[model samples]
Target: MSTQYTYTAFLYWLLLAGLIVFFLFLSWDLQLFQTIFVQDITRISSLIFILFIAVSVHCGYRSWFVASQSLMLLKIKKLSLDDLKLLSDDAFESRSVIKDFLSKVLNSHSEPDKTLATEVLAESLRGAHQVGWFMAGVVIKLGLLGTVVGFVLMLSSISAFEQLDISDIKELMQQMTLGMGVAMNTTMVGLIASMTLGIQLLLVDRCADRLLLETIDFSLSTVDLVVDNRGEGGAPLSAQK
Candidate 1:
């Protein structure tokens, strides 16, 4: 399939992914959702948007990062000039190289920057949020299109009879129904996905915050170990939990 078709297919798949995630949340426990509904609707919407951002970003980075780990992608932040040259060269041998390079670039951790956790979270989220933005725009345009078509149906119902025919009224109602369905489907799905995603994102964001805290602790106490090439001496991976 063409790249465009493939991407479009992924968007559809993302919706399915969102549905699955929702069901999984319910299976795990649905009480969390109840608390959210009690809050303001506007707040709820914002939360949903953020969820879309988080899920998309987390998922996008997870796919690539997990794959790179199998190749023993240690010291991603330490790639040298030679590695850069290898990456930039026309002679690069593998499709995986670009992905590796990206993994390294995104994984960078330098001095005086924000905590590694924050940077990592921000960098990883770009692609997913991009997808979310595109989907949101599509929803808006589709909504508008539905609005226009609804109007057309209303106008079409007013024939030269100058009096409303029962048949015309029935036909107009059907046309309006179809038009409204086409118009609102995207927006409704977008909003719902956005809301569900928002809730998921809050859980993730809080988790990330906690992880960042642990990472900071690791950085402070293990600065010597990390800088001395004793990365394994840092805190246990599960410390964040």
Candidate 2:
């Protein structure tokens, strides 16, 4: 399972890298970077937007990987206590919620203790989804920030036209137009980044939900197995025999 996760993560990153490179190539071919990044306003916003996109993509991949692992676990129709113990061992050797929960269960002697551990594990799983959501909000806020900055710059450019000289009007108008362009470019970049990241985050949220459900079900099964092994009087079956 650890190997599978590692392979999945590797493949996801590789695909992401390829897509980023392809996007860069396409932007270069379209001369978008040259035109949009010509000014400080657009350039800075674009850089921030790109950074957020990368973070969002990485977060999405992590969520997907975790969810995929949980889904795989759900496929097993039957899992005995020994099978679960082995799985728990593997999980402990790696970084996984299943391992943490299983470890807690193995150490816990009562149903209430196991239930508490399960709750803790669920919280841990939720942390990942929360991060994706927070980042998605940040991406949108950055875009809005760029929009405000662009408009401020555009308004400031109006000072150049105060003289109202006919001969200089053309140049002033050109400057004003440039400022508007900066404003629009930043706005566009921000919106595009926000929307793209929003979609990714949405998917992450869905996967997280499914993963949580499966984890809960698995924990319940583990609890039942432990209870059953203890026999009717809460004593080990082997002791009764």
Candidate 3:
């Protein structure tokens, strides 16, 4: 098997790091952190910011996990039944995703079920990123919520006006400015957070998909069940290949 797929996680993290660096530079250049966190009275931007970080971290962990499983799959792809049995005896190696899967195949007395394994792999590999995707959407909604709150704040200032006077005009403008800032800042933060986290989770999802597909192929072509063909109604190992 080509080892090219094993680099997926490394490349993903490298690209992610580059993006983070660029974004940090941009934030520092524009003083964005202070503007969004310090200037906003509603603090929605802060919440969104924190959630984005959390979601991103989770995404990174998932990516690494899927990648590790892929590596393990590659390692044992050509192992025979006896070889797999020897590996499974090691406590640490047996804990790996591919090892656990092969253990199931090795122990089954019935026909090897590739379809069931595919479903199991899909759930194990691809399902991990769903939470991050959801949270990314929440970040965007939070930003919009900030926008609505800011607009309300702006409108409330206007409502307080008994009459248009120069002194009151200055105060009203300040209040309106504050409200607008809240709306714009929150909206901006939410959008940035959502987009960044969405991109990361999307990459994780793709990596997971690739891992699952490759595992399916490997299982179909390589892994063989250790069962008696005539007695147990199981196909011969050669038939599986």
Candidate 2 at 235: error in angstroms? 22
Candidate 3 lDDT over 103-127, as tens digits, reads: 5655554554645655676787767
What lDDT does the true structure give each of the candidates? 0.43, 0.62, 0.74
| Cα-based TM-score, every candidate | 0.40, 0.73, 0.85
**Worst window of 10 by summed lDDT in candidate 3:** 228-237
Query: How many backbone clashes are present in model 2?
Result: 0
Number of the predicted model whose TM-score against the real structure is largest: 3
Name the lDDT of candidate 3: 0.74
Candidate 2 deviant stretches above 4 angstroms? 1-24, 40-42, 64-79, 83-95, 106-112, 229-241
Query: For all candidates, what are the clash counts?
Result: 3, 0, 0
Model 1: worst 10 consecutive residues (lDDT sum):
68-77
Q: Which candidate model has the greater lDDT, 1 or 3? A: 3
Q: Hey, what RMSD does candidate 3 come out at?
A: 4.5
Please, what are the lDDT tens digits per residue for candidate 1 over residues 110-176?
5534344446644442334445455545444444554455455545545534766676777667655
User: What pairs collide in candidate 1?
Assistant: 48-194, 51-197, 51-198
Per-residue lDDT value at 53 in model 3? 75
